[model samples]
Target chain A: MSTASVPLPNWITYGLMPLLNLLVAFFISGLVVWWIGENPLEALRLLIEGSLGRGDAIGFTLFYTTSFIFTGLSVAVAFHAGLFNIGSEGQAYLGGLGAALVALALDQYVPWYVTMPFAVMGAALFGAGWALIPAWLQAKRGSHIVITTIMFNFIGAALMVYLLVNVLIVPGKMAPETRTFLPGGQLPKLDWLMAWFGLKLGPAPFNVSFLIALVMAFLVWVLIWRTKLGYEMRTLGISPSAAVYAGIPYARTVIIAMLISGGLAGMMALNPVMGASARLQVEFVGGAGFVGIAVSLMGRSHPLGIVLAALLFGILYQGGADLSFEMPNITREMIVVIQGLVILFAGALEYMFRPTMVHIYQRFKRA
Target chain B: MDFFDIVVSILGSTIRLSIPLLFTALAGLFTERAGVFDIGLEGKMLAAAFASACVAYLTGNAWLGLCGGIAVSIIFSLIHGFASITNRGNQIVSGVALNFVAAGLTVVLGQAWFGQGGRTPQVSGDGRFTPIILPFADAMREVPVIGPLYANVISGNNILTYLAFLAVPITWWVLFRTRFGLRLRAVGENPGAVDTAGISVTWLRYRAVIAAGFLCGFAGAYLSIAQSAAFIKDMSAGKGYIALAALIFAKWKPVPVMFACLLFGFLDAFANFMQGKAVPGIGEVPVQIFQALPYILTCILLAGFIGVARPPKAGGVAYTKER
Candidate 1:
C-alpha cells in the first residue's frame, strides 16, 4: 500500500480487495471451528438458517443490525477525522443512562412518538459528554486518544456498576437494574414492515430504531461528504500537515468529529434499552461498540458498505446463538473470534494480497 | 482486627497483587522503549494464562506450564510483528484485533476442552506455584514491629513475586548499562540513525516484542498458577491495562515502574480491605473507585496534568527505508 508502484482501479481496490480479505477471515474462522471438532459447513448452515431462515430469526438479525449500524457510523465518523474512538463502548454505556432517564421520566406523561426525540437527544448528549475529555486530550493536550478512550471504558464500567448497585437498583429487587420502561417509552416492533415482506414477525426485539438507524446512516453520508466540517475532517484524516497548510483548525475538527462520533455511539443505546429490553441492564452495550470497528473497516468507512457489513455480522450474531447439536463447541464467542479475524485481515493486513494481485495483473496486461 | 494486622495484611496483599503488574509493566517497558506501542499486552497475557493453565492441568508441572505460556505469547508477538512490522500496517489496529482474538479464542478453546463454563480445570499438586516460606519467617514472627513485616509482607510469597521484584533492578540494569539497550532505545528515538549506523531496525523491534512476550508469559502464568488455581474467564481482567497505566504513570522508567505498580496494587488491596466496611469519617467507599483509579490517574498523567509523559519519538510508527 505504501509502495503504490502499480495504480489499481477503484473497482479492484474497493470491491475485490475487501471481498478477498473477508474470505480469508472467514476461512480462518472456519479453521478455528474445525479445530474445535465442529463441522465448518454445518456451522455455516446453522448460522444461515438461524439468522435468515424464519421471520423471527430475521427480526432478531435486524435488531442486532440496528445497533451495529449506529456503532459502525460512530466508528466511521471518527475514522474520517483520523481518530480511533474506541470509547464508543463507554459512550454507549453512558448513553444508556440518558435514555433510561428519559424513559423513566416521560413514560407516564407522553406517547412513544413524543418521547423518542427527547430520548435520542438525551442519549446523544450524554454520549458526547463522555467523549469530551478524550477529545480534548487528543485535540488540545496531545494525549493519545487510544489509551485515554480505553481507560475511560474501564472507568465507565466502574461508574455504571456504582450507579446501578447503589443508586438505580429498585428497592426490594436483587438485580442491579432500573425498573422496566412503560409502554410509552417502549419502541414498537416493526411487525407491519415484516408483514409487508410476507413474513410473520415473532417475539424479536426488532423495532423502529432500525428505521432510525437507516435514516442516521443516510445523514452520516451527508455529514461526511456534503458538509464543510466533513471536508475539513477528511483533509485532517488524510494528512495533518496538509490540513495545517490548508489552515483547517485541527482542534476544532477533532473535537467536533469525536463529539459526532460519540453522539452516534450514544444513539446505539436506543436499540437495546428502548427497543429490546426496555430497561437499562448492566453491560448492555455488549461489545457492539467494538464490532463497529470491524464494520467500519470492512465497509471502508462508507455508510453503504457499513450497512452490508453490519448485516453480515448480524447474521453471524443471530446464527451463532442457535448453533448446537452434537457439537456445541462453536459458542457465541466464536463469533468474536471471527470479528477479530475480520479486523486482522481487513483492517490491519488489508493489502496483504495486493502485491500478488498487482503482479498477476501486470503479467496479464503484458500478455 | 487490630490496625497493625490490617496494615500488615494490606501490605502483604499489595506485594502479592503487584507481582503481575511488575512483570507486565516491565514487559511493556521493553516493547515501548523499542518504539512499538503494544496495546495487545492484554491479549498476550490472556492467551498465555489459558495455555499455561491447560498444560499445567495436563502435565501437572508448573514449569512446563510456564514454558507453554511463553511459547503461546511469543506466537502472538510474531503475529503482531508480521502484521505491523512486516506489512507496515497500523500497529494499534493489529493490537486491537489480537486483543479481541485472545478474548474470544481462549474461552472458546477452554470450553471445548474442559466444559467448565469457559474455564480450565483447577490445577493442584505441583501444577501450582506454592508460596515459599523464608528461612527466618518462623524465627522473626515472634519479634516486634519488623517481625510481622518480615514474616508476612516480605516473605512467604510465590517464586513469581520474588522474580518480579528482581526484574525491576535487572530491567534497570539491562536498559541503562548494556549495549543492546543503547541500540534499542536509539532505534526507538531515531530508527533512521540506528539504520544509518548499520543496525537492522526491524530485528531490534522484533527482539523487543519477543522480550515483551516472554515477560508477559510470566505475568499471565502468575495470574492462573501462582495467584489462583485455574484459568477463569477474563481473569486477566484489565491487569494488563493497569500495567500499561503504570508504565505511563512511571513515565516509562524502570524504578518508578515498581513504585507505580505498588501504588496501584495498594489501591487494590485497600479496596478489598474496605469492601462492605465503612470508614469513620467517609461513607462506604465504592470499590469501583479503586478499580478505576489506575485508569483515571493515567488519563490525568497523559493529559499533562501531572507531567508530560513523552513516548518514544518513533513509537507506533513503522520504520521505512524511504523515510
Candidate 2:
C-alpha cells in the first residue's frame, strides 16, 4: 500500500480516488436498501431532493454542515501535529457548558451583540481548558492521546449529567436542561439574508453561526498553510526525529495544536446553543464530534476538503430524514448504515483499490 | 437493614454488573495482546445483543440465540480483520467505522424485522437464561456469613456470569502457557521477527481477533438474554469503552483486567446505591460523581500516576515487509 509503487497524478489521487470510493460505498448501501425492499435509486433521489431541492432543506443542510465544519476542522488541526484527538466530543460538550454559563449570567442584562461574542469566547476557552489536560499528558507524560481523550469523553458526559440534573435545571422543571435564553441571547438567523435577496426562505435554523463556521474554516487554512508554526507542526507530524533534530519543541507544538483543535471543537457549541436551541441541553453535542473524525479523514485533513466533506455528511443527515419519510422500510438508522459504509470506504479501507488504480494509470500512460 | 445485608447485596450487584465488563475486557485482552487495538468491542457487543435477542425471539431457544450472536460477532470481526490486517488500514478508523456500521445496521435490521422501535420481542421461559440455584441453597439459608455469601452473592446468577469468572483464569492460562499465546504475543511485539521465524503474523492476528469476537459474543448474549429479556438500542452504552480503559489499566494482563472490571462494577453499584441516600456530612451526594469515577481514575492511571504502562511495540503500526 505504498504510494511510491506507482506514481499517480495529483487530480487522480485527490479527486478521482475519493469520488470512486464514495461511488462504491453508495453502491453497497443501495444493495442494503434493496434488501429491505426499497428502491435504492428512489431513496437516493429523495435524499438529494430533501436536502438540496428547496431553500428550507438547503438551510437545514447548511445548519448541520456548520457543526460538522467546526468539529472536522478540530480533527484536521490535530492531525497536522500528529495527534488523534478523539476527545473533541467531550471538548464540544464542555464548550456548550461555557456558552450556556455566559448566556445564563448576562442574557437578562446585555444585548445579543455583547452576549454572543462573550459566549463564543467562553465556549472556546472552556473547550480548550478541557482538552489541555490530555494534551499536556501526551506531551510531557507520554500518555497516549487517543486513550486519554476517550476517557475524557466519558468523564465529560458524566460531569454534564451531574451539573444539569443537580444544578443547572430550571426551578421546578423535571427535564435536565437549563432555562431558555432571553431574546437577547438568541442568535439572529440568516432569514434576513434571504429576505434581502428577495427569496422566500421558509423558517430555518440556519443562523449567523454558519457564517462563523465559514470564517473559522478560512482562518484554519491560513493557520495551517501560511504560518511558521504550521510548518513546524507538519514537520513534527511527518517525522518526529527530524523535527527534533531541527530543534522544534515537540511538547509546545503538541499543546498548541491541541488547544487550537479544542477551541475549534468548542466553537461548535455556538451552532446548537445560540442558533437553534436557545437553551443548554443534555446530549446537545450528539455524535457530531465522532462524525468529525470521518470528515477529517475523508477530507485529507485539508480545510477546503473538510468543508466539502462536511456538506456531504450534512446532506446525508437531512436527506436521510426525507428518505424515511418517503419510504417506510428505509428508516433513519439505514442512513447511518450508509454513512458508516462511506466512512469505511473513504477512511479505513481508503487504499483498498489504490494499487489496482495506480497500476492501471501507469500502464495507460505507457501505452 | 444491617451492615451484613448491605455488604451481601452490594457484592451481588457487583458480580452482576461486572459480568458484561469481564467478558468485554477479556475479549479486548485477546486482540490487544495480538497487537490489534480494538475499540469496536462496544459495536460488536451491540450487534451480537441484537442478533441474540432476535434469534431467541424467533426460535425460543437461548443456546441457539447465543450461537447466533457468536456467529454475527465473528462475521464482524472478520470484516475488521480484512480491513485492518489484510488491507493494512488505519485500525482506529476501521474500528470507529465498524462501530457506526453496527450501531446503524442493528437498528435498521431490528426495525425491519420486529418493527418495535428497534427492539426485539421480549424472550421468556427457555428463550432467556434463567437464574441457576446451587444445590443445598435451601438448607444453607439458616447458616451465617458463608451461607449468605454462597446463597446471596454467588448463587442464583445465570450460567454466563459463572462462565465469565471462569474465563479469567482460563485466559490467564492460555495467554501464559500455550504455544499459540507465545506466537500471538511475539507477533504483537515484533511482527518482523515472527515473519523471519516463518510464522504467519497475519493468521495469528486473525485468530486472536476471532477469539475476541467469541468473547464479545458471550458478553452481548449475556446482556440481552441473561441480564435483560430483550435488546435495546445502544444497550452497550459506554461499556465497550470502559472495557478498553480497563484493559489499559490492567496493563494488558489477564488477572488485573478482572480486578479492574470488578472495581468499575463496584463503582457502578455504589452509584446506584447512593442515588437516593443521604450522608450525614455531605447530604445526598450526586450519583454522577461515582458514575464518572472509573473514567477519571482511568485517565489518572494513564497520565503516569501508576508506572508507565507500555503497549505492544508494533501495536498501531502496520507491518510492511520491506520496512
Candidate 3:
C-alpha cells in the first residue's frame, strides 16, 4: 500500500473495486450479526435458505427479482438518455392500476390468453403516458428531469391513494385495494413442469415472470449495445449538443427513452399481480421502484449489471426477513440501513477511497 | 361581528400558519439563488425542531434553545453542501439520504435522550416563545381593511414571526441591491462563469447553504417553541418539499415567493377551519377531504403545467475548480 507508484488499469479500477467493496461490507455486517448474539454461520445459512431454500422461497425470490429487473431497466434506460426517472414508483403504480383494470374488465368479456396480454399492454400505455410529460418538458424547457420526476412520484402516490381508496375499492371491501385478477389474466406458472426435473425438489418459488424478466434483460443488452437507436440514446445522454451535431433527433430520442423507461416500469407490476400475489394492493410495489435507483446506480446503468444487481438485492430482501425470525429483537428494517449504506458507498465510491488507492498505485509504479 | 368577524379570525390564523413556511421558503430562496437545490430543507427543519425542543425542555430557556436548533441545522446543511460541493455526489441521492438519516437518527437520539421513541418532553409555558402584545397591534385593530389587516394579520405573532416577515424585504434587497447576493445568484445560474469572474464557487455555495440552514433553524424553532410545545417525530412531514415547490412556482423571486407561502398557508388555514364547520348553506364537507386539499392541489399544480420550469443551470451540479 505505497502512497504513490503505479497506474492501475481501468479494468481493475471499475471491476475489482466493486467486489472489494462488497467483501468489506459483508465482513462488517457479519460482525454486526455476531454482536447481536446470532451466529454468523447460522445467519448466512438462514439467508441462503430464505432466498433459495426450496420451491416457495425460490418462487418468491424470483418474483421479487422480476419486478426489480424491470424497474432497474427503467432507470437504466432513462440514464442512457441522460435523464433520471425517479417517477418509476409512480409509473409502476399506474401500471398496476392499468393491469388491474384490464384484468377486471376482461374477467367478464374475454378469454384468458387474450386478456392477459391486453392487461400488460394497457399498463405499458399508461406508464408510457405518465413518463412522456416530464420527458417533453425536459427537452423543450431545459427543466431538470430529476426534480420533475420526483414531483411526479408525489403526484402519482396521491393519485393512487385517492383512486384506490375511492373508485377502485372493490364494491364492499374496506381495504384500499382492487379486486383479484381473473385466472385468465394471471401469468402462467411452470411449477409442475419444473417438478418433472429433480431440481424442483426445493422450496424455490420460481415462475414464468422470472424468465420474462431475464428475456427482457437480454433484449435490453442488445438494444443498448448493438443497435443504432441505442447509439443515438447513448450519444444524447453523454452530450445533447454532440448528439444534435450527429443529426440525431434529440427531443425525439429523449421522449422515446422515457417512454421505454416507463413501459419497462409498467411491466414490473406483472410480477406481483400476474405471478406472485395475483391481486392489486396498496403500497404493493413496496418501494421496489425506489430500490431500482440503487440497483441501476450499482449496476453502472448497464443491462447485464442491472440483472445481477437485482438478483443480489432480491436475495438480501428475502434473507433479511429470515434473519429477523431467527434473531430476536433484530427486525428486517435493519436491512434498510444496509441498503442505504450500500447506496451511499456506491454513489460516493470515488470520494470514499479512490484518492488513497490511486496514490498507492502511483508510488508502486514509480518504485 | 358575524361574517366579518369570522373572516377576520381566518385572516389572523392564515398569517400565523404561514410563519413556518415563510421562513423555510425564504431560506430556500437564498440557497437556490446560490445554485444549490436544498431538497434537504424538510430534513433540516425536522432536525432543528428536534434539537430546539429537547434543549428548551432541558434548559428551560426558549431563546437559548432556538439558537441551539439553528446551530445544529447549520451543521447538517454544511454536511450536505460539503458532500455535494466537494465530493461531487449526486444531489438528489444526498438529499434523500440526509432525509432518511434525519428521520431515523432523530428518533433514535430522541428516544435515548428522553425515553420516548419519537417525541421530546414538553416544555413549560415559560419556556415557550409567546407573542409580545405591542401597542401597535391594539391601536390598529379598529381601522377598516388596512388597519384590521395589519393588526389581525401581521401584528400578533411571536418574535420569530416578525423576523421571518422582515427576511423577505431584506432578502430582496440583498439579492438585487448587494454584491454578495449578485454573486450568489450568478454562482447558482452558472458557477463556471462566476469562477471565471474570480469568485470562489465553493465558498459561495457553502455560505448559501449555511444561510439556508440558519433560516430553516428558525423555521423549526417556530414550529416547536412558538407554534407547538413539543417536537413530534416526522412533524415536518412534507413541508420542506412543499417549500421547494413554492420556490419553483415563484420562479425563485423574493416577492412572489412570499405570495406562494401565503397562498399555501391560507389553504392550510382554510382546511383547519372547514374541519367541523358546514359551508354556509351546503352540508359539511368531510374532514379527510379538507385535510387532503393541499396535497390534492399540489398534484393538480404538478399535472396542470404546460411546460417545465427551469432552475438555475448549475443548481445541483458541483463546481470543481481547476488550479
Fnat by candidate, in order: 0.69, 0.74, 0.06
- Per-residue lDDT of candidate 2, residues A321-356 (tens digit): 887888877788886787778778888788888888
Better of 1 and 3 by DockQ: 1
TM-score of each: 0.98, 0.98, 0.84
* Regions of model 1 farther than 4 Å from truth: A1-3, A324-326
Give lDDT tens digits, candidate 1, residues A2-22.
445788889889999999999
Best by TM-score: 1
Count of backbone clashes, every candidate in sequence: 0, 0, 25
Candidate 2 lands at a TM-score of: 0.98
Q: How does candidate 2 score on lDDT?
A: 0.90
RMSD of 2: 1.4
Q: Which is the leading candidate under lDDT?
A: 1
- Of the two candidates 2 and 3, the one with more favorable DockQ, higher being better, is 2
Global local distance difference test of model 1: 0.92
Order of models, best lDDT first:
1, 2, 3
Q: Which CAPRI tier for candidate 1? A: medium
Q: RMSD to the native, candidate 3?
A: 4.7
Question: Is 1 or 3 the stronger prediction by lDDT?
Answer: 1
How much DockQ does model 2 earn? 0.73
